[model samples]
Target: MDAHPGTEIVIDRDAGPAGKLAMSIRADRAFALGDFRIDGKLAGLHGQAWRLDATTDETTLSSSDLPAIRQLSRADATRQR
Candidate 1:
């Protein structure tokens, strides 16, 4: 989060399996969990930026790349080479 500051993250365990990871990037003018707002242009959709949801069997690693990920835990072997 060095590049972007004031990022808000929320993990809703009660939402779905393995829960939902919601990450809102920092905006020039944005609000998270806001009740209501009326503006012409909200800052990058005004706080609702990205969502990272992990399912029970979802993964970015291919079968061949599993070895590297098993070691690094979050490594993308395909991009390293």
Candidate 2:
């Protein structure tokens, strides 16, 4: 999930009950939640904050999702190479 250089990736957390939902970004497209995975594209990042677009296969989601956005961002960052 390593974001491309100069790409913006944002993962927002603390918005659900499970407290473990997140979004992934790459470029212009985004992945919200799908078949057990959420993916997105890089939008932008400022300081310690990241801005990303959200997109997914599933049409909708419940209030509680898994893999907080923050965690997803962190994982993607770590995956960066």
Estimate the Cα RMSD of every predicted model relative to the unseen true structure: 15.3, 11.3
Lowest lDDT sum, 10 consecutive residues, model 1, at 35-44
lDDT of 1 at 42: 17
For each candidate, give its TM-score against the true structure.
0.23, 0.24
Model 2 poorest 10 in a row by lDDT: 58-67
lDDT of 1 by residue, 1-81 (tens): 122343333323334354443222223334342221123111212212333233433311122222221333223334346
Predicted structure with the largest lDDT when compared to the true one? 2
Report every candidate's CA lDDT. 0.28, 0.37
- The candidate that wins on TM-score is 2
Between which residue pairs do clashes occur in model 1?
none
lDDT of 1: 0.28
TM-score of 1: 0.23
Error of 1 at 80 (Å): 1.0
